[model samples]
Target chain A: MGYKSKLSWADVTPKAAYLNRRQIMAGAAGLGLGTIAGPVAAEVPLDREPNTLEQITSYNNYYEFGVQKEDPARYAHRLTTDPWSVVIDGMVDKPGTYDLADLLDGMDIEERIYRFRCVEAWSMVIPWNGFELAQLLTKVGVQPSAKYVAFETALRPDEMPGLRSPVLDWPYVEGLRLDEAMHPLTMIATGIYGESLLGQNGAPLRLVVPWKYGFKSIKSIERITLTDEEPPTSWNKANRREYGFYSNVNPNVDHPRWSQASERVIGAGFFAPRIDTLMFNGYADEVAGLYTGMDLAKFY
Target chain B: MALKDTINGWARKLPTWPVYALGALPPFWYLYLGFTGGLGVEPISELEHRLGLLGLQFLIAGLTITPLRNWTGVNLIRFRRAIGLLAFYYISMHLLAWLVLDIRDPARIWADILKRPYITIGMLGFLTLVPLAATSNKASIRKLGARWRQVHWLVYAAVPLGAVHFVMLRKGWQFEPLIYLGIVLGLLAVRLLRKATRMRPHRA
Candidate 1:
């Protein structure tokens, strides 16, 4: 109920917090974002509220429990998200073990409805509510030496039934170039659909790199290591040909096994099997700037 | 008598080469279509459906060879190899479609297999073929000797699994799966008939 200054467009504009999400959804009305239509544009909160959004809840990446898609949703319920701590170290100016509460304190969370594309060429539209990674790194004062920001998930082979497999280096790590980390599209998600994230959906915290394949957004972290060299992620070490460190989305570069030109939108069901993949998952306007003059086919 | 012997010579070789090529065509076509994107408009689901159907077709083809050899003087005994290979090939593609396209995530791929009974059984069916394909070679067959048949007995297990993979993938007892189940049952019945007749003989 406080009077605010003139923040243009979505900021101080008269609309409710569905905010940029409705804008994206409206644009999605035309594109193949799957059965969603955005509400009318407004300077104020629109009368038509955002649809009851959903998260792309998934099985935990732990393979030991059995690599079933539904297993994580069932087993992840046992994971403890409370009293979490992330050790930030390496090239950062400020390195410390910060509690979850302190790290997330006073942060603004926004809902970004994006098409979650898997390397296997399946996808979903998830309404993720998170603060940008740039916001958090700024608090810790990211150093000039920090060229890449890497995240590590907690690994306990004993408890996490999935971690029992050596298929991936447990305590999975994912990284982003400094520019990619600060990109508005890069998020440290804590919630979805305006509700707190479920345990299966990387509760407590997880990264959301919209342009990169889903694996790059590592989940269930224990640490953040900002490094000068590109970090060795679990997937890259596992298969050099299939997974690469810079896994930018490019339709031209077909994943040796499958083509990336399209993706099956999971919830879309039998009648409608898939949706056409977009450039940077349809966040082209926001993220296209980062890649500038670079040829995507070569980098991809 | 000279003409009869000449015709018999050509007839014996006929079933081996051409029928083998025919059975192989389906899987080769599937691979070509998939890689080239000919499976079309509904690529993922369509490819999945076609791959599963092709697997069932090859299963039927392997089964049909017996009938062909039995009914026609053109015994297609050698073509059985190609039929079995194609069966394995189609099933392999089916697994790939599910693993890469259907599930998508490393996390979810494993989850789909472990969590879903249909997928788990289908995965088992697909994996069971690996040893069979490896043993299909004369080297392994000779190496394994008497145990080759026992190891290949896993095909019996694979047959049911392939059916189950199809049944559950489609969900419900639809006509397509039911038709496949019917063919598989008929094929198994023929094999059982031959086994029973063998066991019953010696009175003559």
Candidate 2:
């Protein structure tokens, strides 16, 4: 495999409607069992791996909008992503604000079906369309002194009600070590499910570090700063005991509140077995070498 | 007064079946929604949360029967068994949803119950309901007699503990869970006021 693998566009399409029709037909044949038994009968018929677009789009935790899992889908329509521009500053030689159009001028968007694990112990397999973040960083010409890459989301208080309360420090920020930032797996995604990303799913542009927790993928990025000092991340700043900067997916290192050993696969049925969480979210083959000598438990 | 009379009339004639059937509606609705994918993404989580909330609501509703009778002379005592049984069913399903769907691993399930304060409280509340559910039958009521009345008082502890579990489960200060806590406290307050009045010496 190369830096990223591309899945066919047709592969991501959801069969929700078709599945529902089959269930309805089955329920009609079993009318003697009554409506009570209809739903249980429906769930037993099919087995499909990919999450439906509805599942990917509706279930999100963009704390900018609200904390409820469904809040982003309900409220993110108000966010304005059209006239978006990302400021690339700090130690980079080409430090300037570039519009989304200029940023994507010559970039090739590849379809990546990645396993997205949330620190909350849930996961989704998403088909994301984007290019390697290292490509963009290279174009900007990183200075020798830069050792970390800091990111900031757009600060829109009126559009984002969650900002009204100090749930977290406003304008969420995250950072990656220089080598991690330059890793080939690191991507700045613009779309998902072969379509332009919905406002809730970090429209316009967002970071996607697949091996890290979902929170590290910081949404609707407005600033990209290359710095030497470690940046204060939103969650790490909120609760150091629970969240860490690295936030890598490690089953061995449990979250103080909950076990990280296993995760609920989203779109899997109620009785579907929870699978063991993989080291580095199944990307250990590609990323484990990056942290050779360091203790992951301490970092995590 | 007329509305109260009408409710009491229906409560006397039909009693258990109608109210018991009311409890069945939510699961059926949830099942239909589940099959149709009406429950938003992450249907299992949504279903679990909804079922848990339904259990708490019915438990609270069963608690309201005594207070309603004391205040308005509109007794729903006859239907209390149906409501309590429904609460038990929903709560059992809620716990199963978390065990079977959300957490999945049996080892971690024990760890979560022991370690997490919210999960501990929720499980304790579930355990408290066990004896009450076991003795919900007429046979147990006849055998235990006055002791049954004392044991069933566990609802007072179980309902509030369930509410506190909900408040603790969600992150940060959310008003929805707090509102649920407020409702439970308000019901308890009403009961306490009645108990105080009943204890005072009555003038002949």
Candidate 3:
């Protein structure tokens, strides 16, 4: 009831306003948040299957809902994610804003099984429905000078109560380096839990920068700006010491407050001490080469 | 002899068990809600809000005890341990809610703490209360003696920080958390002023 009016949930159904339940849950591919259903299998290895929005949203991470063991399931319904748009601007050769409809037109989306790790030390393998970020950026014709991509949300202080606070730069700006932008794992998602994304989960469009912590996958994207110099991201500007732009998930790289050496699987319940975290969140082999020369310790 | 015997027996029979049970309600509500499928909805914002508010309520209650005792002759001393422990319990629940219900990525969790100061502070507030609760019992308090007071002093630092954590975690300074902060500050001021005044010895 408290955060209801403020940060209700992602208003994702705008485009899906006319769609059915089955249609709403459809991701880039037809995969939903619960691609396979029933609390993601525990023993499944990282490469076993693709993670879709069904699995991703089915498994959640919106703390604004509340910081509880099952707050997402408890408070997810309060969101109304519809009537959304993306403003494409900044360093791009061919840049033009697009309504949520236009943005969803071109690509054939697919389901990718991604291992999600929070900076807080918990993990879930979600089947996400989205196309690669590179696919869309390519269409928009990002310029060569574009070294980093920054995203922003609409500062709906009247609506998003979270924005009413001085937490992170309001509008929630998040950025990624160009190379990271082009990576195969990066995506822009619209649905989860096998349904159009709930309002709390970043409805219309959200960046899914897997392999890194979840925040890198900025949600409810309203603005896209490419900058030569590093843009001040929401987290970095709010707390410089804690949140650096390159927040890759390395177990060895401890957070200033707690150790990242371990994690607990979402839905696994309490009494489960955090499981040992893997390098690159178990995606190091796939994405580690991206940072070959750069010091992970420093970047982290 | 009759008065002394009867007074001792009545004091022993005073309402302690039920007050303790009343103190356990919030945690029990959370468990009941989860089991009864109260949290079966798609997104979990509502559950989180309730738990967080509940945590704040418990914290406020915990901190309110000393002042309540000072202000009113209400001997809530027996329930103080339960209230203080519940604060920790609710915060842990609030934190777990974020961990399990919200973020499902280990890497993401790391990123949140490192990138988000509010989360870091919130987590610190949670962690500091652990030992305090663990030592709340008579046995641990007796064991730690003066050190128990030192560690428990963290509650003073924690309650406000928890509010700060709540305030900072919000994208904006919504009124509810601010009110929570305001209330906690008021209670803390009373206690601090009391302690300061008591320590001011006969100067003039």
Candidate 4:
């Protein structure tokens, strides 16, 4: 089955070579490949050019791997993604560890291109290949009492060096209100650039909440618990003042140190004009109802 | 003795224009990298960081001149102005990079300078540099006389403030920025210790 929509962009990442970062990096490290091939152009129409494969894969803030932007790509290759299992429990009918492949055995995967905004005021538009989280939750049979969906990233200290350092509480956690979790736009991404997700970009499994700050979309998920209680998030736990529970993309709400009114799009050339950040990062029409009558400034 | 004097004389005779030319290289290299798509993924941010560090390095170099002569007797005072002016040039570029590239909106730029502590200190450093840079020429030095030296002492304040600004810019226990602060503090210690020794009374 295939899914199609009017929401399209002039720039689509060329499918073939973007996924092979590990191969290229390995080749560079004396595996005998001389050239790192660039992403070839494709005919997918879009408004603006997507960040290059290098930009998308390399420049990321996966604190689990490390703080520096290049740290993830440099370090995440050690992570073991094959035969991954996700432990699902708390207010679910089917409460057990499910193999990643078995869980998504019958689900249809579609490429949903959405704007990803980081709390640090950098932005990117990524084409994510995954099914809606709503479908997954439906598959698991959600109990009526479940109000929030809590996620826990895999805590492999040896594989993830940053985990050894006291960056935050271990097994980095993130949560979403059940409605937000069940939203059509909210996805459990398995891939990008039309290929399987790279280890650095949260391979095997990761949450993708396009409307929220990039940190809210937790990576390398090992557990997803459907619970009635509000779960403690990693960033909010680390510094509650800076990172709030509801990390919605609202330009009006300025981060304590940096203004969120505008963002410098990564890979946009040297003098490229900074674009004004939109309400809910241009997904307000779809997600604003989720936060109706609530003060985003306070919640943020 | 003759060779040492000849080398020193040659160094003294060297044109100051070369210092300015050499001083321009780092930014020029960064500019070339920017135009050539070689500044990695985020060029503007990279350029902003590199330019700031270059300014700080030059500031440290300028501050070293007095101590260098005092401790080593190398006597490189003639190049101090060129070095200081170069520091100001890089500092100005650092400020402009933040202004025009990083934060494109002018209103937001003013707001950031006013609101954020790091930005405020950084702006203060830049403000102090402006007067020093303006009066760097031979004409202003002659016109102002001793008052010029007093005014240029703003460098003492500006350099440390810039270090503080840098330290505060980073998040959570960054050692690199703190190391920079350490270098500034170390230089200040040398200046302070020398001042204390000069003030001590000597017996016949």
Candidate 5:
């Protein structure tokens, strides 16, 4: 049974408020107003209202900044995002360091409102602004031999205090199967609520895999490598027993330390009930085919 | 020695009822924060964590009293029972926050306590404190005599288990929980070493 959210659409600031903000930012950037019109209406099923911008930006899991939720907001501002570039290599036709703007130049950035479930059994409904990861892979021309896609976050000791902690090995890495990377639902988000992504929220670029746990959506990405071999992910490498490579949101496959059966909704007030967690975070209709016959309990 | 004597004088005059009254304030303050948005977006978890940490701190503080008295000659012995009861109070609140505010479902709570190793360890630690807290009064102390000290010795097991629970709950091998574990182990070691030295003289 799908658990309904206690929150109502009216409780949250309307999506139009952020769209207007985006329009102003887009106007200033010399982007045509026409580009925003087409994708704003594209719907992804959202059971709950999107968290407030303050709630989203203030509470983050970008551990490169620090392990604490608020650490990202406090320390990420020191990161230099203006001159960011992504190095895309390994089995890709166009394997070069591409400037952030040049890479996203012709791509269609759209608003996808998705339920983001963390492995810690808490969740948020985020309104992310970006295009599908498939578009980027298609543009880069993925080789037929490429089986897995590896991603790496920027490692700057001067800017990232959490790097000193040796939490999950410096320069946190993540991976997805080539098919997963090329999935239409997979997005490389650059902004939220029509504003440029806050540095704490992975600022210049981050991955958003809605069906999987939040850690699968690596933040502040610096490298993308398409490889024939299955790539090692930081969390999976750190504790293989607890974190699997797939890390899909299955309520049945519990994290070793906590139950995944239900999740507390962030910004849903103090007394709100923990809603039952869904298989693949309620994206089972769209993404369950990706894991058809595999035993999720074993694979998880 | 003069400074120690002066501190002990102050400690003697210090009424422990104030500690009970004051130590109870933090959980209420955390509840207030949860209501007022001061505990951030995920207040239930934050509240649970803060209460658990405070419980551990009080447990550690209670453990330190005997060592502090033996080493520094500063008597905090009068406040030990009060500190220990406060620890039990905070820990009970921490468990309540998890059960009532966070989980709410009885089946889930039961499943978590059984399945999750960290939660199992935490429940074990909480269980260890129950008998000690129940027997912490003057009546039980007088009735049980030497057995009261034996029952309270359960603190040795409870503190370490609580620290281990903290260590296991964190995402990775974090130093904060490790440091807490280290402190607890060190305190236990100090007690053991003192016992060893005291026995050595008698054996010799």
Candidate 6:
């Protein structure tokens, strides 16, 4: 063999600094930095400060655990995360159940600091550690006929107490257009701030389409089906008027109950003024192309 | 009967002013919670929600006064005014919290009140309570005489509207808000049932 060097990038640069650089680069790339940064430059940079882990783990809207914000934090510890498997089926070349570890094996996990916006007008800056969802789709081989990617959360009534309640019809389902699903920005987060994801924060594996509302980022994914037609999402199915299939964070299109113009930043303290919600949650340059010429107001 | 008599006797001895003083403490406690970070990440929203829910509880409690006397022989009639005023006080504070803490912008506040149906219904409920609160004094009660009872009938409308506001505020069909609405409706239905039964003998 030719003279091989054992030193890796991590060996040369400090691990923390290397990780920080990668995170900054990933965040900048996601924000479409340099091209059209002028609009967002004026507003408070959303993804600069990641929310505290306590705030992230404590406050969640995982209805499978419960409807109350604290319910998931209180009850999600009961979720058995190990021995997890995800079923990848529908329109794909290789369709079968795969072990979580086996599926994620050899995939490069990166730190991505993203602005997580909820349809309910609350937001959080989350530093997620995961690989691009495109990698998984590519490995599985998406068929040309596939138009939508439908995802399903695990339903364990014995473990998940909120399943007992008829809250949004259990096994919280979410979907994205195949193009949107295949976007480089679309991530399958397994950890938050370098730690394994808490059960409340969608342990094992969860989608993180930062541009879309938080609900679209389905948690504890058990099944992922690539379909020709648009798949039904939980909130969209619950109320078509309020939640749309393409729940992109559009400030102009208001949810019937609440204004989308502004969002309350979590961990920003009680008295902090509400920040103006960004178009596509400040990732417009990357994803806004997907919704070009489509009537967002009508769709929303 | 002995237990009911004992309860009513205790109610008679209980001072109404203490209800006002004690009822006023919760909002301050909630403020303390907000300041101390006990209200979680979104403290302003939490504080606003807590105050609104407390106000709704007081409204529901006020509705139960007549029924408690009718069904259980426990007369809380002397405390009705105190309960009603407390409900108004809590609701006003709730509105104030939303105005001051949650949405400080004047134009946006006005826009929400006008544009949003839930806010409109909630505002109407608050307006309904205004006359009831203003006319709660002995002077107005004596001056309005029989009309005071009619003015206070607005509470019947106001309480239901409060429940409806709660129902509409939620994202989807939440059981908690529906349960509140159910209780209010059940209480109103009880009053209607009592009136119908009482009037049947008059018809006979």
Candidate 6 DockQ score? 0.33
- Model 1 earns a TM-score of 0.56
Task: Please identify model 5 stretches exceeding 4 Å from their true place.
Answer: A1-46
* lDDT (10s digit) by residue, model 6, range A105-139: 87889777788999989998777889889999999
Could you give the interface RMSD of each candidate, to one decimal? 16.3, 5.7, 8.7, 7.4, 8.1, 4.4
Candidate 2 off by > 4 Å = A3-50, A164-166, B1-14, B67-74, B100-105, B189-204
Worst 10-residue lDDT window, candidate 3 chain A: A1-10
Best by DockQ: 5
For model 5 the local lDDT of residue B17 reads 90
Better-scoring candidate (DockQ), 4 or 6: 6
Best by lDDT: 5
| lDDT of candidate 1 over A1-300, digit per residue (tens) | 111111112322223544344334434433532333112111111111233232155423334243545567778767777878999998777799999998888778776655566776766555677888888898888888879988898776665776664556667788888999987678898887667877667777989886778878887778998889888887777777667787877666766445576565443322232345667765566677888998776666
* Candidate 3 lDDT for residue B87: 71
Q: Over the stretch B72-135, how does candidate 2's per-residue lDDT look in tens digits?
A: 9898898888989999999998898777656655667888899888889999999999999999
Rank order (by TM-score, best first): 5, 6, 2, 4, 3, 1
- What are the per-residue Cα lDDT tens digits for candidate 5 across B1-204? 999999999999988899989998999999998877799878889999999999999999999999999989999899999999999999999999988777776777888899999999999999999999999999999999999989989999999999999999999998899999999999999999989989998988
Mind listing the fnat for each candidate? Answer: 0.00, 0.43, 0.04, 0.39, 0.70, 0.48
TM, every model: 0.56, 0.83, 0.65, 0.83, 0.92, 0.91
Per-prediction RMSD in angstroms? 15.5, 5.8, 10.1, 7.4, 7.8, 6.7
Q: After aligning candidate 4 to the native by TM-score, how far in Å is the CA of B178 from where it should be? A: 3.0
Can you tell me which runs of candidate 4 are displaced by over 4 Å?
Answer: A1-46, A163-171, B1-17, B65-78, B137-146, B171-173, B189-204
lDDT of 4 by residue, A1-300 (tens): 112222453346355654443234333323221232111111222244455576788788887788777889999999999879999999999999999888898787877777789988888778778888999999999999999999999988789988766657788899999999998889999988677998888988899998899989999899999999999998898778888999999889987777888787676666555677878887787888999999888899
Of the pair 4 and 6, which is ahead by lDDT? Answer: 6
Q: Report residue A270 deviation for candidate 1 (angstroms).
A: 0.8
Worst 10 residues of 1 chain A by lDDT: A1-10
Model 6 has an lDDT value of 0.85
Question: TM-score (0 to 1) for chain A, all models?
Answer: 0.80, 0.87, 0.77, 0.87, 0.86, 0.86
